[model samples]
Target: MKVSFDPDVAMLLRRVAPAGVVWVLLALPSQSVYADDYPCRVALCVPSPTNPWSIAACVPALERLFDDLAHGRGWPTCEGSGVSMNYVNTPFDPCQGGLNEAGPGAWVIEGKKQPNHPTWFYTDPASYGISPSASPQQSAGGDAVANASLACVGKLMGTYRTYVGQYNRDYQEVNVAVYDQIVWQKPQSPWAIDVYQNGQFSRRVHWK
Candidate 1:
């Protein structure tokens, strides 16, 4: 899972500005080559809080998390690898949004959609065996996006934590207890998501 960066890509990484740099790095000619090698597409649903600025602020962290998952774990494998990651804004509460709004618990892989599934990389302490009342430490001003992104990454990687907060009520709990349980369906329908949680397996359910 050690991805080797081409010389040009390495140079670009060092010189590019930090804001939204992940997109630029991933768009390099080398990455296109990698895509050609793998030949599959992936779309990720990143959390988008109510604050408008939060999405822009969190873009870097989201990109990094996406890259880590894509490269570190060899996800969307050669059999399923056109490799496109889309970041959709989702409200914190699943019940708050209208049909047009990207509410919580939405999921999409490739082109297929699973409207009832929790957003990919989303976390709720209670679902991971932590107390329902424990809250995450509040991030200081300007650091909120970074901290949020880190938490998402940690949860996606199966790093359990204990935290209590009022917002816990807003998050929809997903049963994915570990990262490995997130699986792609067979090659016949590679875009399908198959999840194993709490001793039960759930297949890719069409968006309602």
Candidate 2:
């Protein structure tokens, strides 16, 4: 579903747009636009001391991953702790905080920073698979937001690193301006998130 505002409407929006507002034009996949059976809201849980979109501010690589996942396309490689689908059958509560434990593996999000990079952040979508065009500023902002969100979730989930660090966690910072650039970019659609885990791929997490 390619969603575009008519030029006239766009002009009108721009004229009346609030300060700091940016308009985006997107050509999104149909699966992203349509509803689905997966009631559980899923987020990409890249634990391993790392963390990793929508409207939802998203990039081409992210969008592509969602599209590919919906169509039975292959998995995108992940580094460090690898990715997992932390699912919450109900909305809010667990989904906003973190996923619950399941089975023997103790499905929890936990990790310490990888040895090579202490101040590491997961921002490179290309490393996973596709490297869509993105400016340095856009990438940096996205990385900041991703790291912040990860740390926030990690702290909430009672992770050792986040708890011990005494870092001032602000979940609100997850939506800071720096990260907004990634989603506000033009020409791409962002509907959901996909992650490869447990020797198989998780379902496409439809946009809320």
Candidate 3:
């Protein structure tokens, strides 16, 4: 979730960048040979981030990401493809009441529907169910990572929070805080990226 503005913000993002901020798409296995071996349909969406610290980058209009993840091998995220990419954004505080340097502008994501508000603020399984996800069977993480993180934060605050995305692919496991920071885009080795902003990859570097 990036705020569109003067080149300054772009330049800022270019330098600091979000963590796991895949500057480029991940490379995938050739579909002609291993199409059937991939996981569930991939879905991705880049939510509009109105400010920093907002939980909007997590989920937004996800139909497109879900589509490509499920149908287009050319754009991995679905079967034979890999993971999904999506974004959500928090609204800017006109009054500048939030804890943001440039007003309350933050990016957010919504992989799972939240509770009791409107849209992300208020969600109900009975009314707005969670997205379809692959069984945790072959997953390396995903729901599990979410559950784990929730257990820690939920217990501390004594209130349930949002679920985070945990890549469940077979290739590798990666820390996803990158979605927020946008700085981990370019990392040195020891960090064999199994997952990237676009999808999955082999040994190579790309700049988005």
Candidate 1: how many backbone clashes?
14
Model 3 TM-score relative to the real fold: 0.16
Give the TM-score of each candidate: 0.16, 0.22, 0.16
lDDT string for model 1 (106-195, tens) is 231111222455555334443444444433332112323321211111123233333232464634332322331222221121222332
In order, candidate lDDTs are 0.30, 0.30, 0.26
CA RMSD of all predictions: 19.5, 20.0, 20.8
**Candidate numbers sorted by TM-score from highest down:** 2, 3, 1
What overall lDDT, based on C-alpha atoms, would model 2 receive against the true structure? 0.30
Q: Which scores better on lDDT, 2 or 3? A: 2
Backbone atom clashes (below 3 Å) for every candidate:
14, 2, 48
Worst 10 residues of 1 by lDDT: 146-155
Candidate 1: segments with Cα more than 4 A from true spot: 1-46, 50-54, 73-208
Kindly list the per-residue Cα lDDT of model 2 for residues 1-208, writing each as its tens digit. 4467544434433433334533332223344542221111122222111222322223344455556667877555433223454322321111223422121211123222333533234323332222244212212122233312211122321111111112575322121111110121121223444444455553434333
Q: Candidate 3, residue 38: CA error in Å?
A: 23
